[model samples]
Target: MAKQAKAKLDRKGLGSLGLEKLIDILLDEAAANKALKARLQTALAGEMGPDEMARLIDKRLDAIDQSTARINKARARDMAVEFSALARNILSELGAVDPQAGAERILRFLGLRFPISARLVADSARLWKVFDDTETAAQELIQSVDAEEQVLLVPHLERLRLRDRYGEHTGFLLGLTSVLAAPGAHAWRDALMAVLADEPMKFGALDLAQRLSLRLADIDAFLSLEKRKPENRRDTLTVAALLAEAGRFDQALEWVRERPRGMRLIPVNGSLTSVGPEYGAHERRMLEAEILERLKRREDAQELRWREFSETLNPEVLKLYLSKLDDFAEFEEMDRAFAIAAEHEDIYLALDFFISWPRLDLAARLVERHNHDWEGRYYDDLAPAAEALSAKEPRAAVLLYRALVEDILRRGIGMAYPQAGRYVGELARLMPELPDGHGLSTHAAFLAELRRNHSKKYGFWSSVPGGMQG
Candidate 1:
């Protein structure tokens, strides 16, 4: 028996992205003479030894080889026919022969056709990259391109003025478009790429490129004024605005610098960090709105909007907006902040603001919204949990007294946590193994009191005995 021929597909050659199509056509041609081929192979194999069978396979491969060239020519003709038809269609979607539009169309053509194994189209993009290399490279580059690729781009570039980002920065249209068309920092990266094209030159290319490529860490380092003081930063930031069009700080960072220092490096690793020129809530909303609109991601845009009913004059206006808006999964940040605002005891408001709330609940949720100080909120929440322990509710007075002992730590007093001496004795007499001890970082004096009262049972003088983390 003769074995089937085996050969790997060749990826190289003109416009071979369509190789599978050509292969299909070759197989179809072979199959058309099915009866003749079967008889011929049977006779040939009968007379031929195994070594000779290999020669027959080689001959068959040679015969198939001629078919590939023919397929390529046919495909080229088909593409040109399609391109002409597509050219007429372009008049409808694209404006005119203006340089930008022509350049844009060239890019669009390259992008649309490359993945189909269209070797010609891939080469075309490469040609454009080369043309971008020098002043007169475009025409020479066109000459080298296959006749098919030249048909469309040659006519288009006659009037384009792309002196800014051509040459070594030649791939802006492809790379920038590719990056921006992707999900996140690609847009920002594309904006920064203009400097490579000599357009308002500023920061070092490799540095900016490397930094933006660091995934979500873009938010970690705020654009420091220090970077701006040395020149290029202002122009660079401007370019960033024009390229992205979203997150227009409008010199907002200037205002931020006037204030004292500290909270600079963007919200850790979150996207919208403010090094000074941070965007206000309204501005951030508008910018995000425009981008989503352009991307045709309207549903996502709408989802980012906060509620429309918040009072404009509220002290925590941003907080109110946050509660109304719903972009982030953590919907309760503003809710928690506002809830914390609505309570108190012997503590001052200014001081409560200082207590490092990095404190959270079971789900790492902020504890403020859990209604720590408000009797109404706590009674409402704890009511069910309290009822669950109804056997203890039977001992309500004693438990209520124990609850007061717990409050010594639960209160959101700033650095000031003066644990009243009254509830300590009963708490130690009851629940001994609470998660955190009585010696919390809440305050110095209060911690001292907790240690004295519950030293034998509570161990250390703590405050937040049951808070969770987010």
Candidate 2:
């Protein structure tokens, strides 16, 4: 019988490379080297026959061709990930993106250029420091970061602004400003206001600053800036005009009363701040009411408001009022706060109303009216509310939770990590307190499984234990 072939089909040691690669290497060497080819040809001819030698050569060449095809196929499959992690390392070194560009652009470049996960977009963004341009185009990196995974990028974005540059490069600036200015984006209202003050254009800055200052219940910056030297008649006039326009009559009157007589020659033609005069208590109250009446007189004014009156009143004021109402060792002012809050139909007003009242029965009813998506935390109040519910009626709180969970699942709004986690943990623990014995452990277990299968979707920090807010 003819000698069995020396090459085995099982090419185990070569790892991913298959039988064809081994055959190709051998054949290439023999074909490229005249001495080797001649030597092998002679050996084959002598050992076997002309027909056998020819058949062996054909077999090897065919195998080599097959190996080349396999290599090409593998390359096609990995076309996207060819750069793998090396690309991320490269982007990170590039630092942050330009002030004009966002991190999403960077991630897009990476995904399109190198084929990476979409989530990596934010990682590219981190490499971009807004004021200093370097990491701008790494869309994949920035997206990866923005998906709430890093938790720090949003804050970082919140703080960055171009105090120096101007113009179309404003997109990045817009991105930072948009994020910081977004209602319910963060509790650090003062920091956001400070960033806004640095903007080169008056464009969105004034409005953002106004809303933030109001929400923060702080007119300190406003009052301070007003007191500083006026840069131009227009800037001062604009401030006064807006105050007057807003019907902050008392404040407006005071500023008008304070204006220097030297400026009287400038023109009362401008707003009160341009000339300066102070409004007394009676005048202020009367002016505030007049401004409201004037605003009401304009039918077109409805279109001017961004939100309901309560939502528009500045978060800080509402926050302060609500905190004072809750005053359970927090602060004090229950009666007046509730009286004022109840007069408004606003959900924001309702939050203040409930905080002042702290009645579980009222909270259960009010819960339906509010947007749980509010990024603000009420963890400390949760204990009181939960206890109130437990004391008043466990069944009712449990029922309310059932309704809340259903609504939450149905709406699919993205709750920030801390808030969602607190509610989930508290609810889960309170499951036993509910009328139904269907322990949240079952839901928790299901959540575990869901997370196991879809880690990114389930999100992390859904619930924190031991009553910790972070």
Candidate 3:
């Protein structure tokens, strides 16, 4: 006898159980579950009209706002579910019947964000996510409301912004830029500008004003706000990129040409090190090239692209350079690019380029040529390159695997022993396929060397299958 398949719990399956049965199940579940009961009551109120629905949702919001209890993890999760359900009712039930009322209630719900966040004993990602999602939905609802209504809601939004003590609702107001009518936008701009006027270095106000200006397509306002800050290479590049995007090529060019100042320090081995004023030189040059292209300086653009490619061995830049060449010139340029990549100072970068370019044959040859330079510390690049070369170039793969194994044992990185053990297994499998004069030791010889040098690395040998006999 064959086993029977279980019925799925989908709408179709449930419908077959009859509406009376479904109602009985809901009654049983709702009696025990307070959240479900509230949701059912909200749904029942929706049938009365948008007014009744809004009243119920407003009552819940008021109760939530008035409560000052510190919510622990479990209650936080439950509260998140409740808040999400309220937001859904506001958007679906109230929004469908009366968008204006729905939008107002959404704003009221959003106003509870700071208070709710403050009352939490510990951080609640679940509650925060609910708020983020509700904000997004509120934006959509507000956009759907009448323009005059949007103008009226600006004050409410401003109130919300003013009450945001923790900067939790960072983009809430700025995200409404598209939905705001001209009057509403002007009102919002004025309010943010007032904040900036009183506190010039206020990051939140200045950021909002600048972003709103861009949304209004007012580039001058954006730049004027930018000028308030001290100029640096990073900001200069940003202004230039924005100018280029706005099709003001000449001004963009001037911004890009501004002499970069100040040393940009970056983390290296858990310490800050100065990378000089040329920190983002590559991006600056690329942006300059783009501006030159827009200005019809094809030769200059190609020249800049080639320089970037030569210095970085970037495949994308090389492709862009090749794309601009006349027909049939791409093939010749590609060969030139490959030769440049083979001799690039960073062997790992060159390998990355070839692997990304899918020129595995050249990647294998490049690996063999720079065999001694393959560092296991750079397994990030070498491991993937080996995997790519395994089928067609097992010998090269063996070399990379050997480097990885040696580096792990040499450094005594116990955490990486299992990974090294896997590599050892691969080397053993690839040994038979290796031709003579590969300039690499046989698999047995390599294992014996590992044992001689790192005999106490039991963690590594144990992880290897067959106790390293492979």
C-alpha TM-score for every candidate: 0.19, 0.25, 0.77
Query: Candidate 2: where are CA atoms >4 Å away?
Result: 1-340, 356-361, 365-400, 411-470
- C-alpha RMSD of each candidate structure in angstroms: 22.2, 22.9, 6.1
- Angstrom error of the Cα, residue 365, model 3: value is 4.4
Model 3, position 30: C-alpha lDDT score: 88
Total residue pair clashes for candidate 2:
58
Better of 1 and 2 by TM-score: 2
By lDDT, the best candidate is: 3
| lDDT head-to-head 1 vs 3, winner | 3
Clashes found in each candidate (C-alpha, N, C closer than 3 A):
25, 58, 0
Q: How far off is model 1, as Cα RMSD?
A: 22.2
lDDT (tens digit, per residue) of candidate 3 on 1-470: 99997899998899999989999999999898767777788889988987898888888888888999989999999888878878888888788889889888888888898888789999999888988999898988988888766667766777787777666776676577766666667667888787776763543666667667877789999888877754431367768989999899999999898746776433233223456777678889999999999999999999999999998988889888998999999998899999999998999999999999989999999988988888899999999999998988998888888899899889989999999989988887888887777777777888888888988888999998788565
Candidate 1 local distance difference test against the native: 0.36
Ranking by TM-score: 3, 2, 1
Q: In order, what lDDT does every prediction score?
A: 0.36, 0.40, 0.83
Superposed by TM-score, candidate 1 places the C-alpha of residue 86 at a distance from the truth, in angstroms, of 16
Per-residue error for 370 in candidate 1, Å, reads 9.6
